[model samples]
Target: MIEQLGPPTLFFTLSSANTKWPDLHKLFPKTQSNTVHHNRMQFIENLVNNPHITTLYLHLRFQIFRDEVIVKQLHATDHWYRYEWQHRGSAHIHGFLWLPQAPNIDNLDSSNHESIQSVKNLFDQYITTWNPRTEVDHLNKQYIPAISNPCLSNTGVISRSEPCTDYTELVNVVQCHMKCLEYTCLKKNSTLKCRYKAHWPEQHDSSLTLDHNNNPSYKPARNDSRLNVHNPMMLAIWRANVDCQAICSKKAILQYISKYVSKTEHKSESYIDILKRIVGLINSEDTILLAYHRFMMGIVADRDISTQETCHMLLKLPLISCTRQFVNLNVGKKIFQL
Candidate 1:
């Protein structure tokens, strides 16, 4: 596909927050006799017991996103995506989109300022790191009354006239996009460093520049360096954290994404040794049923399966989806035409 179509225009990740979604919370029955704390616990319990609900919700939301954003807004000519489960059992999608009109990084001339600026303009059109909190701060400096979360209402109604409605939605729902120090980012190297490089340098203006490796990199004008780049409208509609990045280096980005999408189940060295021993114990004289049982035991040992993942598989949901049909060509075989 890469040989035929070149690299994808954008590489993105969309994450799901099952607990944070009000729609998912509402799925549980409300009881007058239950206290607020009790109701919250019950709701969590329901989610744990019925993992399929959240899995299905994630699938449905992704479908809506594909139709509304990918097809309508971006007009992606080709795309591919895969779903993966997080440690906490939440589902997330990693995808690549090919936009026919997007500028090809491979063809970009770094020496030409006009060309670089044009590419930056196109990137800024779809992705941004602007936070609405800056606007609130500006208003407060001018002695305007402080605005609160617009979605927080007992009646569950937001006035369209409310000035902070959009701001509140972006800040509240996309909270996860904010970078913070965690185990995942903390690398245990000689000198500990953040794997995500969360401390992005503040840029006064958006610019398309070359990185240390001479790979084209687009840095959007950012007041809050901690906030990840995202599409504002898409973030609002999805009501979750999302990351959008330009494919600066075709080979690098493809290799990175391919590693993630093709990753196998993680197995420790000790587990591998055990599996090898189990295989060794199975002799040719052994019955097929006995050998199969031994092999299954070895494979199952130390394998962790989250409830959500189990539900995802049991429900027969697709883990991968692509817009274009692919055909396999055997380069090793000789073709003879009669």
Candidate 2:
């Protein structure tokens, strides 16, 4: 009820008369047209099924190995404002390979189709709001600078005048891959982050094809040299259950609280000073403090907990007068929910 229909619905659904009647279609746009909104909802849906979405693959799938040996290459020099206007720099040998996978979106075909269509529909949907004869048609022609740039392609680089449908597809593929990795992390025991990309020559074209020798035709790995991004594994940490320590260690609880606090992004005179704000009030401000405490409580509470227990644990001040408030909690909306 809160996430969908949202807050505005309550305002209108309860009170009929208003001096200013706003447009409902704009706020409650047709579900078909809101790709971003749908993607967000879909992502939330995916999180419920698995916290570690395939996106976690970036941290789990690839490995990048580095060596300290430095080699100097005489490439084109550009006179930049930085580096004292020096054009020469040394490159390190970071060896790696980029492997591709046929991603499985819950092994469902419709999910894959929707993921792809979301990218296209978003672009097309935007064009619909503009005047077709002038602004829309004129903007379409301006894409040649990015699409037809000979300088980047000939040199084994893939640069676009603008990030187009193809670029969006590539991004979605990466995101889906990461989400899968996140799924693995949650079920297992590791924190992962992906930071790899297909190499220069292989990435030179949108086709992303390779030759018989398994090398990019335009920009071979030998020409570019470094290979660290080949396999996706980037960062790893121990993954355990969400840390809840109001009844356990205060330190671990502090770290968990820090993650939540960082989301607020308040400025202090300096860092590490969060102690000044959230420490002693662990009991009061039940509105905000208890809200999060209740959310964290959800981390460990089993599905069978009675409504009275849940309401007391989470909502220190319940909005509803009845004892059935706990019946409203659903499984899919929160990051750590079922």
Report the lDDT tens digits of candidate 1 across residue range 1-338: 56678778778889876655655655555523322232445666767777788788788879988989888888888888988876435678988888877877778899988888888888888887665665556333222223333222222343344536554455544543344433246676787678778767767788887788878877888766566788776666676778888777786776876787697775433656766766666667878787666655555433466678888889999989898787888898779767
TM-score computed on alpha carbons, candidate 1: 0.75
lDDT of 2 at 50: 34
Candidate 1 residue spans exceeding 4 A from truth:
28-39, 135-164, 176-179, 182-184, 261-264, 267-303, 329-331, 334-338
Error of 2 at 261 (Å): 28
Please provide TM-scores, in order, for all candidate models, with all chains considered together: 0.75, 0.16
Candidate 1: residue 29 Cα off by (Å): 6.3
Error of 2 at 14 (Å): 47
- Candidate 2 residue lDDT tens string, 39-158: 334433333343222222211211111111101111101101000000111101111111112122123234355643433332222111111123343334222322321211211123
Per the 3 Å backbone cut-off, how many clashing residue pairs does candidate 1 have?
0
- The weakest ten consecutive residues by lDDT in model 2 span 9-18
Tell me model 2's lDDT, rounded to 2 decimals: 0.23
